[model samples]
Target: MRQVLLINKDPDMHSDLNSLFQENNYESVILDEVETGNEALRKVVNDSYDMLILNLDLPNTNMLGLINKLRLLNQDLPILIYSLELEYIFIKRYLTSGVNGYCFFKNGDVGEILDAAVRISTGKWYISQEMVELIVEKALYSKKIDRFDNLDEQEFEILTHLIKGDTVANIAKIMGVHLPTVSVYKTRILDKLRITSLLELKNIIKIPLLSES
Candidate 1:
């Protein structure tokens, strides 16, 4: 059986992936971390697995460093980035950083993700067809960078949280700000992106490329 390790903060999502993996005759260890950071990296360093499905939006540690360290430790380890945020640039950067595969929670059909795992295990790099189109579209529209670039650091953080489906109150709690503060950031984020509604913002950032079509 193929061995896989999934590092995600959400238990429910991990469970879903675990169930699916079992159905397909793959052995998987689902690490459900409520808040993983550098400490989680320690576990990663010690465990041996055929593949890794990492949540790039993890709140606990320097995600880039974790990937780098993993690469340094085991160059052959196949790493698959899994996240809810499907920003083309982020995916592009991850590709440049040496991930073997990439998939997003919002964008890919569940079957595609399963296929990605199988392909990765077979030493193939697999990016869904829908993600390819999004990457191409974003590249062609490179001139419109400011659509997201105008956001301040805090605004960017807030926007990413929103992309991960955090509500205003949850965002406020996470950011340790008052509800009004999160509301203000949300409004500014929408205005800066020239989107008038939350749904539009979600459409732009949360919906996967496949779902968009």
Candidate 2:
């Protein structure tokens, strides 16, 4: 039987995955709630597993930094993003960052989830049909680069939180960093995205790629 290190918090989802993996002759370890992102990093360092299925929407998660860190720490780990994120543009970065697969349980579709695990375990890549088109579309029509793309993982995290109305202090607490660190990230993200205000950030995320016309 194969094993997966699953970064998940939902018990029901875990239960569902357990049954599915058991039927398919696989098993998984449900990663416990991590107070700090460092704990998750440490777990990956100390443990051995066939796959890593990361849940990106987990609260207080630094989704980008974790990927960057994992790339440096365990370059060969086959990472699969089991995310609820619907935005293909946002997910496109992960696809390029050595993540082996991406899927969602939208409408409770477990088969795709299982398929993602199986494919990645065998050293293959997987991105759903729909997402492929979107990624390609943005790639083909490149003009001036999207400033949003220039923001690193930490900047992206801070930008998204601020766009969602999170205060700088709250974002600091969420990321387990000092208040001033988040402030610096905030300033840097705004500068990189070429936006001066939160209102612009919110609008930009909802629109198509910047300068793609």
Candidate of highest TM-score: 2
- What is candidate 1's lDDT per residue for 1-213, written digit by digit as tens? 255666666657666776777787665544334245454456567766677777777763345556777788789988888767567745665676779888876743566667787888788898866578877776685454435656665676677677667778877766667999988988898777777877777675633222121
* Residue-by-residue lDDT tens digits, candidate 2, 1-213: 155667777667666777887777554433233334577688778876667778777766667777878778888888888666566556776777778888855777778888887887778898876677776776796565666677777777786677668777888887789998998887787776767877777766754547533
Candidate 2: which stretches are off by over 4 Å?
A: 27-36, 142-144
- TM-score to true structure, per model: 0.60, 0.83
Residue-pair clashes per prediction, in order, are 3, 0
Candidate 2 TM-score, C-alpha based: 0.83
lDDT of 1 at 177: 79
Looking at model 2, the pairs that clash are: none
Q: With candidate 2 superimposed using the best TM-score fit, by how many Å does residue 157's alpha carbon deviate from the native?
A: 2.5
How good is model 1 by TM-score? 0.60
